[model samples]
Target: MTDQELQTLVEKVSQESFRQPFCHNARFNQRLKTTGGRYHLQSHDLDFNRLVFEKYGTAELIKVIKHELCHYHLHLAGRGYQHKDLEFKQLLKKTGGSRFAPLLAPVVFQVYQCQQCQKMVKRRRKIDTKKYVCGGCQGKLKFLKTIEA
Candidate 1:
């Protein structure tokens, strides 16, 4: 969805779930690599990872929104908003927000093995066996296979 749509949804969720209007901006942040969402303490803005919706769908995305809202609302009220705080934990459980983001599988990569020591190496980009040697035994490295995981 577009940033405008996300902003509208965030605002709606904030009102319905928290009984508070989210006056700040809410948008998808492509830079969010691991976390599902983030609530800015200074700006009161909400940032969501687009990958959450793309990979897990709307239900999971709503949970993430609620999670961020917990942070947003709690921080604004000058209450305990951190994840470790009792008030934060209680609000999260009450709101049915996800305690942790769903684990995303690591990207597949090419694997190499040392011909002498059989030491394995994995890399996101393919490395030339002619130029690179194994660090373990200073042995020649050979392309093993691609690991899909």
Candidate 2:
């Protein structure tokens, strides 16, 4: 969603869930790598990871928004807002917010192909080309490429 759409969504969510109007901006931030979302105390704005929504879709995005809204509303009301606070935990549970961001799977697979038989093989860990041979024909196995999950 665009920044304007995100802003509207934040306002809507605040009104429906918290019974408060969010008079601040909400925007997609491409530079956000790990976190799902962030709430700026000084600006009172919400910044969301664009990749989270793009990769995981709306349901995941909503959960992330709820997580950030917890920070937004609590900080604005002068309540306990940090992740470790009891109030924050209670509010997060009540609002069904995600406790931690979901991580992508690891990239450890290496793909190989037998040069003579052209058979494909996928290995979790890399193999020594000089020591390993194709299972089917005992032919030479050539490294094709590595894939990351």
Which has the greatest TM-score? 1
What TM-score number comes out for model 1?
Answer: 0.74
Q: Please, what is the whole-model Cα lDDT of each candidate in the order they appear?
A: 0.91, 0.88
Q: Please identify model 2 stretches exceeding 4 Å from their true place.
A: 104-149
TM-score computed on alpha carbons, candidate 2:
0.70
What tens-digit string does per-residue lDDT give for candidate 1 at 101-148?
876557789999999999889998999899999998999999988888
Per-residue lDDT tens digits of candidate 2, residues 17-119? 7788888889998888878888898999989988877889888888888889999999999999999999999999998889997663455789999998999
The per-residue C-alpha lDDT of model 2 at residue 87 equals 100
The true-versus-predicted C-alpha distance at residue 129 of model 2, in Å, is: 20
* TM-score per candidate: 0.74, 0.70
lDDT of 1 at 90: 98
